[model samples]
Target: MKLAAQRLIAVALAVGLVSCTDDPPPAPKPTGLNAGTGCPEFAGSGRQIEFGGEIDAELGGVVLGAGSTGVVLAHMAGGDVCQWLPYGQQLADRGYRVLAFDFAGSGVSRGHGVPLGRQVEAAAGALRADGASRIVLAGGSMGGAAVLAAAPTLSPAPVAVVALSPPTGYQDADAAAAAPKITVPVLYGAGELETSFAESARQMYAATPSTTQRQLVLVPTSAHGVNLLNPETGSVELRDRVTQFLDSYAPPA
Candidate 1:
């Protein structure tokens, strides 16, 4: 009987340890932006901000507009916050607060080694800290996979997600595995001519369980990732469709 009791206690301790390790680390405090040099010139009246992680890496970010519904824009691999600036400003003009941030080792952000999904989660916390009551995550390429993986586990969960040209997996984030677990509305888009990314979009959309809230859109061009939204190089129809989707599932007001 004593041996059985000891085994049970050991099992209980093991379970407790697993649970503690599974819980996400607490959100980091904002550390100010660009070391007080102010936001980039293109930010245009946006406020500069920063958030840190366990390794003391500080991510650079820009915030625009004012509202309870905030939109967090994550950029592509090798890209920075500038990649999302134009679209983010548009979302801000529509009454949604917007946050465009640089992941660790990208752009003005410092530090390395943090997982992509964790960086995304930290960005969401930064938006909430900036006074947003709700969140909508949007990303391009590698950023798209990161948001998809993070969405399933984010505290408070995002109200919606927009993924463009995302791969099934990018580094540490796996959108394919995360898709089935996402319960919120999601807009998946890619260029039809960009075969692999387009196929990934389709697979993820098909895998998502929310039949009524998931959408897949493929444009005619070969543009990939954020280029699909570029004013001069992208598809007008795709841009219009995204606007419509946001209005339907995540109205700014």
Candidate 2:
């Protein structure tokens, strides 16, 4: 009887150890603003969306607000949709339907060599499908160059464009070539201390045809790209200038 009891006890211990080993580890805690394959839920009214290019790559995006004028915001290189969420929320609050997206190879998006300008085109189409009648394009750094390059080709063209710290060219996007073709109102902004970008902005402005209503704004601060829109680190004059330009050109409906 004692031998039988000991055998039962050993078997029970072995079963308990197996069960403990089989138990799964607790899920890892969320690490950043983006939790998974969807838009960050912290973006207030922003909703997760997806747009695609000719390749299998599907770009992840977020769209918010309900306005007739649509604004497509492109992020700087190495940055993602999260970079624009704060500013996008502000635009949404002001009655502009804003779509901020991750370009291929960034954020939740996929793909390797897709042209950034084409990605912007896809984003604009997504915004139009979401109910925006008028489109305004905005981008920072690499994104700025992309929007400028894409502006001249967009169907119906953008009513206005805001390029902050745009380069003459980025990957497949060529703002230099596209500038001469842009006939709509264009606002080119950059930090006076970022000499290269400031110079590029000037050159693009010069290349823009005289028929276009073009404006060049150089702020005293050294902030670059979308940093120009940051309420904390960005410039007040630059922000005000952008607001004035948007109001004058694409007034929210």
Candidate 3:
């Protein structure tokens, strides 16, 4: 009887041990988690900073990086600053101060507020007010069109523009009409399999005035927005190429 009890006890111990072996997941890294390299300190949601101000715009956003060059990341329609959180942090790590915001009627932002173009322009202005002498505007999808619309309105003008999966015509913003007005270098891209989106990119590139230096690339992958930048989708070189493109025009942060 004692042997039987001992066997049962051993089985219970084994089960307990197995259950205890399950480890919890690693803690989430803070916003602007650095690459172990020298990166700027980013004040995230806790900061409660408001940068967007077109129509009483109390739009919320995070500011990362302290480099001379600045970048504004515009999220796709129906999305907000959170969409660009990871990307903004990495760009900050790479020496560029990055600002991403929620437009009115999106995310934490409220009110009918201003148009997309005005919202993006306000964001770039806020970046300058924060002390970024040089700026680069970047976005995806509807957000791409927003940056394109804002580019022509910048005072000193953004050093360059990067648009991914930007549509040709979306509501009020017209990429064809705005393309010729882009005064700085531009890098536009889209997924080859995205049909209309890919065609939209081509149209924008062609409409871009011959006077401006512009280039377009079609990724073989069908991912949209920054997803087209994924290396796993055979676009391994896309990210580095973008960095190189910015380095040439904006000269890095």
Candidate 4:
């Protein structure tokens, strides 16, 4: 009995020591854009794509509108590529090539643990290779920060950009630093209720050296990121507004 009791205590001590050692936290899953109201999906538009793992995707019409422009949309942290379908369809209707893809760790593209910028790079490269003469980059929240982060790295560079409710910084992406380097027209949008988010937009706008045009929109909703783009959020005119912005600057050609 004595020997058994001593062995049990030793076993307990070993288990306790193992439990105390910290294991690294699990990888984060994308959220927010995963559900809730988002722009609708096109009935029969876009297609599947494969470039390092896989990406949910769509491609716009072949003929260019005016600038021969193509647009690439990156989704928010938790959401996948489907949410952008409605807007992408609109762009397609307007004669612009539109490409939307999942960001590796999210949606159907999940589990690659790829960094966001690499995903953007891959998407943009695919778009360019597929005949996009010029490109525009757009995103919301984490996705927004991602495009902004990718701005400087684009070889031919995007003609314009739209970042809605982007963070001031994320990981290697510092908007404050990046904004100055981007020499293109930009449309920055934010909601009034989220002070930090609105402030971040303002800071990014201020940092961007826009000689031609740069507009700041303060949407009247608590919505952050792509949620601001949703009509149900009460910012009904955003769709037209974005279309107009793109028309005036990066319109298809």
Candidate 5:
């Protein structure tokens, strides 16, 4: 009886040990998640131009029009528009060698905003220096206004002007008065909710000469600068509209 009891005790101890061994290991404490690089790097000429301390960095701008040509992409707002990889790529796909860079004090570019006219001249100079004889000036908000201010001064004048939510009357009265002088086919797009800017866009369209193929597009449910970055807010439609307008006015090679 004593021996049997001892065996039973030993078996109990063995069972307990086995049960403890079978227990799963405690879960490791979670480390914090890492930050993500927003978009992919742009691929292109890899060339950069330094104009008045602003570095107009080039990316994937080598792809030109139907004949292996390229277009100068001037991004007027702030930040490295290069980060808007999708926007640049979409334009690239449409036969544009996009020259997307920042204004001085904005992106990788080094300088700050000079006089509005000077800003336009500088941008035009950048395009001309890049060997684009027939240029298409596309701008957004401040950029749009800059392009408009710069258009008349371009040596040969830009082939077309596409302004997205451009601010009118921001500069002097002369600048506002000069908006009508843009004779090229002008395409203006704005969000329906952007009251002041939408009105400004309408004013610009109305002011332009009747000879100019002026178009005003009201993007439904889109707000100022909202669709510029967010992919979900019918940005594709906006891009298509701009591209179509550009196609109608692309300079002859």
Candidate 6:
């Protein structure tokens, strides 16, 4: 009996030790755009210009309407080529002259050293150069954060913004604090499975003081950044939601 009691105690202790071992915390959730594969084909006409290098390739934007309103699609951290191509094209088809380009280091854009703010500036410049008077800044993941960070710097100011799976404070609090400054109509979306970023999205929506027209749509059974890529499946729903938001705030002519 004594030996059996000792053996049972040892087993319990072993089980306790194993339970307390503490596996490494799960890998930090990805904050930036993750590169997928393939190149996005551009269908519109402008002038495909190289801004920096292979990464910063600026394809000529398609002019949708005679008006000055435009939408700039910002790429996530990795590159926008394969992932954002379909969505960009969809926006183009919707009659919004869209400018979709890679960041300096990530895509066809030149220079890998450009920071987030500079990328937003580049998008704004593309819009202004193309005669876009009212701009709608749209981005995914880190690109979403970039637009928020650059909001204050845009001279004419963006009329609205659409952020998909935007990270709240992965890097710092500045991005979160910038939320209040975004007074324009803002549309925010996230994957229901993306519990990691759910709180962040909520915080951003809650912090924004502008109640003009703000929305948060939690997509079910989708992964972070996947909805935009598979629009036919779930991405289409996201696009429609965004389009409706923009339609409600049609930019000034």
User: Which parts of model 3 are misplaced by more than 4 Å?
Assistant: 1-48, 231-234
Residue 166 C-alpha lDDT in model 2: 100
| Clash number by candidate, in order | 0, 0, 0, 9, 8, 16
For 1-253, candidate 1 gives per-residue lDDT tens digits of 9999999999999999999999999998855555213335557568888886654678888888988899999899988888888888888889999988898888888876888888888888988998999999999999999999999999998999999999999998999999999999999999999999999999999999965388899999899888899989998988998899888878886
How well does candidate 2 match the true structure in TM-score terms? 0.83
Ten contiguous residues with the weakest lDDT in model 3 = 32-41
Error of 4 at 173 (Å): 2.6
lDDT of 2 at 53: 52
| Location of the lowest summed lDDT over 10 successive residues in candidate 2 | 31-40
> In candidate 2, what are the lDDT values of residues 166-211, reduced to their tens digit?
9999989999999999999999999999999999999999999988
Native-to-model Cα distance after best TM-score fit, residue 36 in candidate 2, in Å: 8.4
lDDT to native, each model:
0.88, 0.89, 0.77, 0.71, 0.59, 0.64
TM-score result, candidate 1? 0.83
Task: Give TM-scores for every candidate, taking all chains together and pairing residue i with residue i.
Answer: 0.83, 0.83, 0.79, 0.73, 0.68, 0.71
The list of candidate 5 runs beyond 4 A from truth reads: 1-40, 43-46, 53-70, 83-85, 171-175, 225-231, 251-253
lDDT of 6 by residue, 14-34 (tens): 998888886666788634332
Model 1 misplaced regions, further than 4 Å: 1-41, 54-56, 210-212
Tens digits of per-residue lDDT, candidate 3, 14-44, equal 9998888886768976543211111123334
Candidate 5 matches the true fold with a TM-score of 0.68
Which sections of candidate 4 miss by over 4 Å? Answer: 1-44, 52-67, 110-113, 210-212
Which residue pairs does candidate 4 place in steric collision?
A: 30-78, 31-78, 65-252, 65-253, 66-252, 66-253, 67-252, 67-253, 68-253
